[model samples]
Target: MSDISDFLNHLPADRARTAFDLVHYMLGKALKSEDADEVLTEMAERIGRAGVPLDRATSIVPLLHAEAVASARFWERGSGARSYLFPYTPESGDGYAHSPAAVVHETGEWVRLWLPETPDDTYGIVPELKEAGYTDYLMAPVFMKSGMAGTFSFATRAPNGFSDEDLAFLRLVFPALAGAQDILATTRAMQEVMRMYVGAEPQRRILSGDVHRGEVMRIRSAILFADMRRFTELTVDMSAEEATQLLNAYYDCIVPPIEEAGGEVLKFIGDGILAIFRAEGAGNVACFKAIQAAQEGLDRVAHRNGSPSFDVGIALHLGEVAYGNVGSGLRLDYTVIGRDVNLAARVAGLCGTLGEPLLVSDTFRGRIADAGKKTSGGPVSVWSVGVHALKGLHTPLEVFAVAVP
Candidate 1:
């Protein structure tokens, strides 16, 4: 035992191998003395795979199995018994039999309890514990941000069960497990934040025409173009920082509804946002969502800046066009490129030309009407381009506008 102690006392000869050996020994140790060691092992493996620190990971489990094993090899003259880690509960004997410990739900907090020994306690013991000739248990709880994540329980076959030293060690290890839970929570939160922006890259490349996807596959979709009205003039009077801050605030107001409606914002060129609603896949639901998103965006922007009003012009077009990843392999963007796309943009630009807040192409109006929906928001009208020939189009298109409601 002293020799083993001496070997571990010095710096590890091989870091990776030492870490591996440490974990293996710990698992074996957990298995030997504890009847419920397998559960702890599963937890340890999960934490390890997540790249959590061993100390932090251990803090979350029944016991830091690895640490227990090392301590056993050093302090206990004889070795090879595993440690059992579980939360303490009243039904099981304080000595060691924590019955029904396997399925007990826990809050993410450490709790200590003394189990009262009784013949009636038989029902609570995990069936496997009885099969393994075990009869007593002790345990502790590990907490997480959401709630009690799990428990660590220890069991023994001895009638007299665990001692003061056993309970003390487990209590000492509880803090470590809690730390690991916090680390995992923070890691997950950061990952979720990253996922939001990272997924948009592929679509960005497709829209930018940096990457090609075997020629553009034309499909019917709802095209949306929104631009901040008089943005150039508005920003010219403000400082760069103020301008940037206002733009960001405006984006914050606009983005929520778009994302909520399952629309993808492809690009933000200057003060305009080009969004696409993949209508074919989600059907009318997608179209409605896009419209809802636009409405929400308008409302949010209006509320964000009150009194001295800031207005946005939006145009929607429903049409078939070449849409997909179109560009060199170096870069690509998932976007639509065709007469319909152009028409939508032209309509958006026309919002400024007509001094209207919202405008929609006849194509968009026709689709919504076919779906049994009425077009609202035009009590206050603007120059309605009744029917005019749009450049590069085979036929004339009708356009209308409404005030910034």
Candidate 2:
């Protein structure tokens, strides 16, 4: 570990005091839950305020994401920070290959350019800095303990550029800054992964310390259950890769429309999807949106079908459900559980038997009626499939088939 105290002892008294104060300020901001961009911007501003002669600074940190890498740039003009997300592809035309940050990253060493003295043919950002009236530019690599690397570049417009003392101070503090950034980046990556795997609302609950098994909340919502028709028959003869591709294609057709209609997809059970449209205020908007989503999903799948077609069955129900963590102490899943959820699944099973692509339970239809005609644009019509006994339930359940327009 790099000790700030040890480094401060070597500096002259006045310089050491100023450096210590600045380091403490930076460290305090970093440790107080401030984000990476905020910390970096504050560090640059503080350095300039302490007479370090910094006019511009930029930091490029690579991310574990599908698209862009994150970066922040600060200019002295407004002392404001601007962030950018550079895409990973179309690499040939971005001019990133000839940037000073690229050189520092490739060589794992610092690159310094004195604008007036640097050769014109230098393969980096030197020419651009010279034109921008910057007298000097320096780029340093920040190599983390995990082998990930980032770049930090500093530029100055001062007549004499950075003094030796200023450069030395920056070199001493770089490690601490990089360490703070790594922590922030790792936290962000974990949150992103959680959001990707579980839905956003569940991830938020888990992060907020709702991890104990049986920690749950009862909430009214419209539950949606959907599954591919004849999935086993569809994939029995195909290779694993081809089967996987078909499943993805099917999801591509169905998932987005549900999300667009304000539903949270809970999980995928084999070829089936479980999602919920949450109730808002005192209305049955959740039920209405669930019905709309089911219709849109079926339409999308029908539109995507060609010679080798895929079909799906979906069902919706509205009632109270237990939403939270469940399972053994060693492992837990953030999901919903209740009779309503079970009822939704059972109703979905009737879709195939009734020869209907979409089905809605009596409970859901009742809620829509209770919300009044204005909420649902008047009474909606459905084909009543009289009370039928479902597996595990002794009482016969009334179900209705949705007539898609």
Candidate 3:
């Protein structure tokens, strides 16, 4: 026998039998030239009677992930996130055998072999399965930029059990498994984005020429509204080209601070921006982040103008808002709505009336204090516009302001 064949031949009766069973199982399930050739005459007859085409990767990958997950349950069911356990790395100075080579190989690859017990038998592709309380294991990688993704891993409880032949067979199977998984993930994400921009799902089914829309999700957040104090009048004096250049310069100065403050610029209305803060953890974090972000915006524009020419009014408020697809499906605007949103706009509007460049709603201000932030001032208000009703709102809101802080 050849070296590879000889290695296979040495397997014990049971292992050898299982190995053959595995080969046959894969051959029958996964279409291949070799398998089809063996039953050519039978295949022809079967095809003549009834034909079945294989489904594409999109349908198949979910099934494969499910199968791997089911198999992992044989070892231990109900483990939170990770169903399959890997070879445990020993603590320093512990009795468990620590092999750097094995550790490096497992960490670097798209596939890994977990032998939980064998501390020393880590050199081979299949780690010492018996010592690690693992009989057979198959691992597939999930490439996600953040946290964990789909991991298809299975394990058995047997000794020196999963041999070279079994390992080689799995290696061949893994590529197809990984590819199908990747295709499904990419397709699902793209489909979600497509659904967002195309409006109705039916519209997306028909159009293939347009840009795939980005998915937007609603979340409770702090809203920041900033506008040029005198943009409408200031631009009238400048030439069209000069106005455009100035606007672009202003955007450059303002955008970075919002981003640095963990805000997404939801819209650029003429010479203003509406940004949402969704990066804060909880509590009044969102409001505090908006305050810091507004400060950053002021500093950036101040530096850019040298003589502080570009005057910007910033306002912040906290409330739940309808924060998803805003524009036509063809051109999306991911923005926010509701009382907090209106309040932010009103606060921005007040920058002119109050003669202060920064203003934050009492709700936003209260949240900042509730989050343990120390600030000096209370109800230093010029207007108590008794619950002035906004255009879209049902109830008039009780609005107050601290023009400067």
Candidate 4:
């Protein structure tokens, strides 16, 4: 490892001051920009303007997200900036382990190699870049106070490769770039976590400072309530890991179709899922979307069933709901609460007793009729299942069962 002090000692005072001023300006601009791509583009421009013969620059930052482990790459070739997300899995570990960025990450130090002189077996990526006409390559780790480390790799096609002065100047300005990266990474992580737990719109609303308990908004929506049939009995004898896997499989079947139909899954209540499709203008578009999602869910569940079948019971209702934050001061949940939400849940409970896979409220059926929107399943028949007293209600509630042909 080369001593950082050696590089610092050789840096001229005038050059050092210029680097400092440039980094200061970059950091100030980064603080004001929320877009990561813009920040990276500006950094690349600044580096090129500093008299370095830069051909390409790449930044690899780890992120917190489902299906992705630790790397998102930003590449700048000339003036254009592009980014790619690398999803990590156990099967993909080998490729990352052998990468040059991995060496910098593991050592927590700089990995500088003269591409023209590097041996074929020295590293996995260097030989390729050398063949592509790169003379110098440097990979450095960017450490943040948050303990997350990112990487910056600079490449040049300049015949003589990077000078000691160029490396020294980079060492001085890297901390400022890393600081700005930390801020962006933190914000992105928070957004990812919030969107994963709560629905997307709810996450945005909560982040925008709508946190007071009992603060509610009345909006019309097509509500869906779905639960796995006999989930308790099925999981009673299974191990904890087995139960979790079973639940995830059920969600895999339930979530995608709803999301594909432009519905937001609000919450998971044990084995049950609550989702909504909010309509922007007139017409029963929300109702149409909810029914389409329910049909897709039924089809997916049927396809997922094996020798011993796993089934689901789904109910759809359309009405106004109170969407907001509700709970104690210390603990709060952002979800929907209203009579319509309760009625949807109660309707879902009747699926097993009524011997039907899917049910819809009379109000929902009326909205479909009023809007003249045909079911996506193409001319399916529906039958009135007689008004019956729901558990918590005094008045008899009429329900309809969709007969899939």
Candidate 5:
């Protein structure tokens, strides 16, 4: 390989200047941790101002994610950059196969197609590019050190297409662009992995260097503990794969409602779940949201009553929770703990024993009444399900079951 200094010396004066400026720009953006969209948008402006006919620019990275196949950002001459996700689907694959990027990815080759001379059927996107007054289209492979590949494409409205100098300048700056993209994509993938394992706040905290063990925050929260009913009996005859699917279906009924109501699902303890809703706005909003989330979760379970059905007992309690990192040695776990969390779990146990779908602790019930004072729904209706002796606690606690609307 030739030295970069020697390579730059061989380029024309203008192209060399543009390439040098762009390398510096890319480095600055990468060091500052600017997102790909911002980098691409600014890159297009700089290249165009440098006498390159860059009307549109795009960066597409094919990453392995649970839901998405690729992440794309496109910037146009007069518009701000926008992002799109190509989901893992047959249609997404079919669309990619008809585009020039797929060819660049498969062949590890660059493509420079003059859109005005090319047939509309040449590439799936050619007709749209031509209609948008673009005459030049270029796609180049950006291979990462991880062996995964991405594509960067440029389009221009200039009738003569991109000049040799323009193409050379872009090619010279490609390494810098690819380096920045690799960093951005890797960071995004790490964040995605964290999101899959932890709630939003925990993910943020961990990413922000707050991962030391014993780092905990105590806050008042409405805790909800729930466990699937008859999970073992229900899946006893099923195969492991089938049972796992059933469990996922059961969790689906519970997790979304909790997340939708601004509650964080902290842990999935086998068939049991522990989540919390912190008090926000006018005090008892956390209790109200927790109650509403429980009801919604129960409603979703009821909706899935037939064939492969799931039933759960949800219990809500209110108190302080110590939330954060707890573990030993090099390994760690982020979770919420406190007597209140235990009380919530105990109340959840009562749901199965008392044959109730939703149960609220006495403290939680009072908060519901208080929340009702501020909400349009008023106090949630409930009835005492008798004072029951929980496993750990000495005094018998009064259990209350919520009313169906």
Candidate 6:
């Protein structure tokens, strides 16, 4: 307490007051902001207005995602702010190893370079900043509650660079800034995890206040249900790690095409994937997109197939589904349940029994025919696989096989 008091007492009176106001803002309004980019842009401008001549500011934090490693936001005086996500690098952690942020992470301390005054050959960005008239660059560490270090960096075009008072004031305000940033980042990370495990549509609905148990929404969509063939038999002799690897490999082929075709993957039931395509009131358009996605997914699986290769059965149908929260207490699950979903799954069973990789319900085919528009990969055609009685269902379903081009 005494050390902090002395540090505060040593600051110029005006700078002390500025620092206090900025810290208060950091602890208050900044944490309430939706995302880090908004907070960083406003804070940079606010601090500059408060007598810190910063021309640029950046916020970097570790991201919780399957495809991305970390996220960075770059803020400039005139250009506002832009966000960038670094993908997972198979070798090292991308080009970040040679970055100033990495040095701060390694030493748990700040790194400041007096721009052009210092040799710029050590880092490529230094020369670029110097050329852009930046005279000072500082990277400070922000220790997050997750036991990882984030960073806030600043740059200035001021001729004399940042004053000693500027550094002191920033040092005083950093704890509050760290708290605000960590709070926002943690919330974002949780949202990312939600999207990863439960999928995008479910995450959006759940976070948008559709969270009450038994709460459901009746939605009309084209359903696509697919499962790996011989999953149990193939995995029976393999280790857990191998089976997981195989499933992930298969999903990589399946999930991407669904997403690319404007469909949402709702769940991964063991080796099975349940996805939906909706065009609001247009069931034909939804069926068209679902058909395209299924075709592309099979092509992808075929392309990615190799040693110990596997096959998949895909089913398409169109109807209403109950989309929303289920289960009880803290164990709530946001998913879809309806006759159409069941029909889609039942059609998937026909894929194996009928010896076809792709099967569609009669309702699905009718919708596609209504679409009438020329679909890619030639005009869509199907072969009648004939109706067959499926387990747990009273009426026999008429299933058709998607003819391979």
Point out the worst 10-residue segment of candidate 5 by lDDT: 1-10
Q: Candidate 5, clashing residue pairs? A: none
lDDT of each: 0.53, 0.77, 0.52, 0.80, 0.84, 0.84
lDDT of candidate 6 over 230-341, digit per residue (tens) = 8998889899999999999999988888999899898899999999987566687788888888988898888885556899999998887778678878887787788788
Local error of candidate 5 at residue 79 (angstroms): 2.6
Candidate 6: misplaced stretches above 4 Å? 1-21, 24-29, 32-38, 77-80, 93-108, 114-135, 157-159, 209-212, 235-239, 324-329, 374-379
lDDT of 5 by residue, 152-242 (tens): 9999888788886677677778889888787777777778778777767778888888889989878788899989988889989999998
Off by over 4 Å in 3: 1-217, 279-282, 306-308, 326-335, 372-405
My TM-score estimates for the predictions, one after another, are 0.49, 0.82, 0.42, 0.90, 0.90, 0.86
Clashes per prediction?
Answer: 45, 0, 8, 0, 0, 0
**Model 2 steric clash pairs:** none
* Candidate 1: segments with Cα more than 4 A from true spot: 1-219, 281-283, 306-308, 321-336, 370-385, 391-394, 402-405
RMSD in angstroms, candidate 6? 3.3
- After superposition, candidate 4 runs with Cα above 4 Å error: 1-21, 281-283, 305-308, 370-380
Error of 6 at 180 (Å): 2.2
TM-score pick, better of 2 and 4? 4
By summed lDDT, the worst window of 10 consecutive residues in model 3 runs over 51-60
Q: lDDT score, residue 156, model 6?
A: 94
The digit string of per-residue lDDT tens for model 3 on 1-405 reads 334456455554554444445445334543433332223222222212221110101111121121121111122322212123232334421321243322323574533444554344454434444544554455455453322244444454544544454454444334444443454444544554444343332234334433344444345788888988888677777889888888877877777877886776766778878778763555376676677777777777777853327788887778655544455667764444566677778768767765667776656766766554344322233334345555566766555553433
Candidate 4 C-alpha lDDT tens digits along 1-405 = 155566568678776676777678677977788666777777777777667677878877777788786655555465577777778677766766777777887888789888877887777786778777988999988776667777888989999988878877787787787777777777777898899888787888889998898888777789999999999899889989988889888888889989999998988999999998986565387887788788888888888854336889999998777777878877998887889899999999999989899899998887666453455444445789878788877777999998643
Q: How many backbone clashes does candidate 4 have?
A: 0
